[model samples]
Target: MSKQYTPREMLEKLISFNTVSERSNLDLIHFVEDYLAGWGVGSILVPDETGKKASLHARIGPETDGGTVLSAHTDVVPVEGQNWSRDPFTAWEADGRLYGRGSADMKGFAATILAKVPDILKANLRKPVHIALSYDEEVGCFGAGPLVQDILSKGPRPDLVIVGEPTNMKVVTGHKGIAVLKTTIRGHPVHSSQLHRGVSAISAAAKLITWLDGKTAENRAGADPECPFEPPYTTLHSGTITGGQAHNITAQHCEFATDIRLLPEEDAESWIRDYRTFIETDVLPDMLAISQDCRIDVAELAYVPGLQEETDGEAEMLVRRLTGDNARNVVVYATEGGIFQHHGLSTVVCGPGSIDQAHQADEFIELVELDKCASFLDDLLEGMSQIDS
Candidate 1:
């Protein structure tokens, strides 16, 4: 426990934790809680029902309206199949970059915020600065839902929220929303020769998948010119499909997973409703004709809302001032910025590093990126101090 811990040192510690989304992040959460406690900042822990992982939130300076929140996620994606030059969990500094899991995808930004704690604590501030950390962000943003609900219920609304997602320190005003779903088809298995006596789940599943592909094509064909996203349209894609065992035997069960990314103007629920209708009305009757026992089931795995630029310009103006960037970018990947916006906070995405470096085999953040982030924090703290004084 030292009074002076640099961002690089903190990142080295964070990267060593191996907080893959499938594993518990309690160790990392506890480490952060302990660090904040040493600086006299009390934090609230929002744990999952299993108590294996948790989110931490703390406020510095005066507890008042119009406070700003610095938000980040604690978990990193799994590195099981990727080949790395060195251990993904061990951080190293070379070639002007800090290489490790979570170094760029996000722990870098978290470390920068943590490094500013002492200065934030010492500053005279009319408004509070909140630190919000959550788990399982890399996997469908599951952990942030409860944590965001807790933050909203606990206090007055924050004036602005900066989601520390790697954007090369540029202000990102928008991103596409993501939805993950799984579909299972059940039918009767029978010999291929006696196909009429049974329903082939694999066949039905293929038809459904083809239908989904048509939807994808349709979406692509009807691209919105005004959309700022790269594709400029919503997208639907299937990730995995599994069914059937023997060549002669008909498949009794088939399941496939699908992902959808929608524009901010697109209604996710409505798209899902159309999908459900297709299953109930179009796909179900044919299966039932063969056997009443045949059925199809669809389940939602995850949903993250898209961030849309507000007309008020509060979030944009603040981020522009902080980063000195006049242009805004839109990313295809989803983040918790949308969640914060849904909860009534003017949110923006601006942080260190590049998105291309995220989720890669040898993930790394440039030391220069961390330096830029530190400078941003210094300027922000100084501005807050001046306003409070």
Candidate 2:
């Protein structure tokens, strides 16, 4: 807790907590809350309705908004299957890098912001530097809404928001949206001998999968002819599929899930509408002919919006000034930046480390990247101070 503690130390402290998306981030939240309290800052904790998780919002300057929000997620993705050289939480530093689960994926940025708090406090500020951290961001950006909603409903709107998703020290203003879906196939079971008479959900599900894959391919090919990305198109992919029992017998049930990575202009609901239309127009009628009870159901698992700022948007200008970057980049990954923009705050993504290292085995952030981020924060805080003064 000494002034000599660098952002990396604070990051190491943060990474030590196992705040997986499935677990409560309360411990991490409280730890951060206490840290800010020691620095004479007050925070608000919006605990989940079930009391399992919470999001923390703290301020170093004026409590009334209208300055900036430094936001990052508290939860890290699961590391169950990945092989690691060391404990994912212990935060080992070597080869000029900090290795840990959330090291690069996030916590590092939080630490950078934390390390600068003393400087921010010392500066003559006219506006607040709101520090907002949320849980379940990896799950779907769900936990941030309520916390941000409360902030919006209570006070002045922030001038800008910086979403600290790893971007290799570059200012990224745009990213693709993501949608997850789980589908169910329902039909009547019948005797194995009665192949034609029975409504085979397995067969219907295969047809649906084929149709979906085709739709995905069509969308990918036809979408955004002026694609800015490497693939430059929407991506649809099935993750899990299962059905049927006996080889000779007609199976009654099948279910599966898919993920849709959409372009900025693409609305996830549009994809849903098209899919439902396909199921009704092409799928249901044929199955209904065999049995009246035959049905297909689709459910949305999660939807993360795209951060599609216009060319040289307000967000772009703000980030450009902060990072001194003249070029903007777009990413395929989804982050809370999109959510923040949707909620009315001008948002931009710019942080430390390569996302390639994110959510992987031996995930780590290079010391050079952290140094760059710290320098970024230094300039940002100084800029805010000058404006506030």
Candidate 3:
């Protein structure tokens, strides 16, 4: 017989795997698959193109429509530079909290879901309960798109999705979208003394970065006072930059990465179009004039749609009924909920712990938070069982 593990034990087991975004999560995925199989629940694997990573989805109870999907990502952010007090992958307990790399950010919720699997099976749910474990969520949410597509195509359509992102168990009605972009500028190198004769890639990059900053300031100045987001407007920021070889020579190459977090009402395409137009009309002509080889290229690394507030949304209503949290809530951080919502699934963000602890040194989830989550799942199971098919 398969050994039954409590939620805390399951969490410890999950935290032992070093499934960082840069590393393959196959080990974790395989473990989950084996665990589910031991319980007689079959899972479908959606492997990425490289076969290095995979997403796992399983359904319990009747194969029917109007089901609830519990979604969580298996991968966690890296702990390379952070000054962790102990081994990040090894789970530890102290002061009524469980500490590990992904304890709060996400894996805590996944562990709870896995621990409740036996209860879910025994609930004899009239409606199905789907478990969606995705990969690469920390890095641009790459795995969720394919995972969502696979779920919709292969199985009965679920009525709602609960993305188990750490929200302290509050139901998040909406969240900002994100568009990650990388800009590369190639220019002719020349002596700094004769700078005017050659285009300077670093200078061009600076101009573009300045333009982005100006746009951010413009949005901030005109932001809606009643907006729930902390800054109350869209934000554009350049996170990383690299280029110039030395101070004496005009930079031959320059590259910088930027991300735009847009309010739910905004469209990412509009912003991308505006940025491209600026590059084509205002920035490129001068560089081309100096040398045809001088060029600017903008590549979109990723784009996750904003989760718009649905009027009388099914997912929102269900979570509110379960948690008794009616206060309006939203977040600035992006999540797979937006992608699921974009694909026509009613979605909400709710789970244990706090987002403030995510990706930090010595991350942890309070023991009380785990108990609250377990009670919520128990209530969910009871509710599912009571619903008529």
Candidate 4:
């Protein structure tokens, strides 16, 4: 059970892979599967439909029902538009921080878990420690869905799941949910001079988009003072818009993407229902009166359930005891923890680094964070060694 690569070294190797949400993560998955194989631990892969990417789940130490699941996502956000001081794919250490695309948003945690493999094997315990590495988390927590189902259906059921989502090592018990919406408005096109003869798709889309903005404002106005989340309520906005062909032409098509983040107590489906009703009752009737072919299509591109603060939850207590932090906080962002919690698993979010560093240019996790995580893993190894029944 001798340790192999240090966390930074492993991070360096991991950051070398361009596991962007749009691309395949097979290389990283294979590397981890092989690494675990060398340690005599077999990994179960839950691959996507195309087999281009997969999630890895493995059990270490003794096989028992009440084991720990160390979860992390392998995908990183895109660096196309951002200006980085260094190559985003290259891992460099300076100013006591490691710089890379996934360093903070999570490959750091994944590396530490992988680095701790030898020590975890060395523990020789009654309960086990599970490793879960998923892909496509940046796009919408897409890859984690199958991974969760896999863990629940196959092998030993883990008693606790720790989602390493960069909480700066503080335990996070609740987080917001995200619903990605894509809307397409189809209208009749005509010469701009004859504005009264045909419907303008872009105009209709603008009205709908403005309506969404108003709804967002309404949600914000109704924010709960007691909620721990930043902004204290659900949020909605458009990320991208495109449609018009020319100023002289009445646009026939308009499309835009909306991002909806819901608080744990807010219902995402309810918002969607209201949106659909608006389109049907308010927006669609006017468009249809002008042209029967005019229509609006709204689709949910991705949805990640939100995690709620649980009272006397075992997962929260375990992390609180381990980190020695009695205080609980909620995050404005979403994570796979909610999905696990929704499926009956006690889940908590805790890991090294700050969410502030995630997705930003020159993203990094402080060297001290990695050191603290290493210490945390060591403590976990020792703690699990003496677990009761």
Write down the lDDT of every candidate, Cα atoms only: 0.89, 0.84, 0.94, 0.90
TM-score of each: 0.97, 0.95, 0.98, 0.96
lDDT comparing candidate 4 with the true structure: 0.90
lDDT of 2 by residue, 130-220 (tens): 8889989998888888878876876666777898888877888789998999889987677778777888788888887888789778876
Model 2, runs deviating above 4 Å: 1-4, 63-65, 387-389
Model 4 spans > 4 angstroms off:
1-3, 387-389
Model 3 over residues 1-389: C-alpha lDDT tens digits? 35688989999999999999999999999999999999999999999999999999999988888799999999999999999999999999999999999999899999999999989988968799999999999999999999999999998899999999999999999999999999999999999999988888999999999999999999999999999998899999999999988899999999999999999889989999999999999999999998999999999999999899999999999999999999999999999999999999999999999999999999999988888899999999898896555
- lDDT for predicted candidate 1 compared with the true structure: 0.89
Which of the two, 2 or 3, has more TM-score? 3
Residues 1-389, candidate 1: write the lDDT tens digits.
43667999989989999899889999999988999999889999999888999999988988677778999999999898999999999998899999999999899999999988998988888788999999989888887889888877888567899999999999999999999999999988889999888888999888888888898899888877877798888888888999997888889999999998988767788888988889899888988988899999999999999998888668788779888898758898899999898877898999999999999999999999999999999888887885532
Of 3 and 4, the candidate ahead on lDDT is: 3
* Reference-based lDDT, residue 6, model 3: 90
Candidate 1 lDDT score at position 10: 88
- Model 1 CA deviation exceeding 4 Å by range: 387-389
Q: Which ranges in model 3 have alpha carbons more than 4 Å from their true place?
A: 387-389
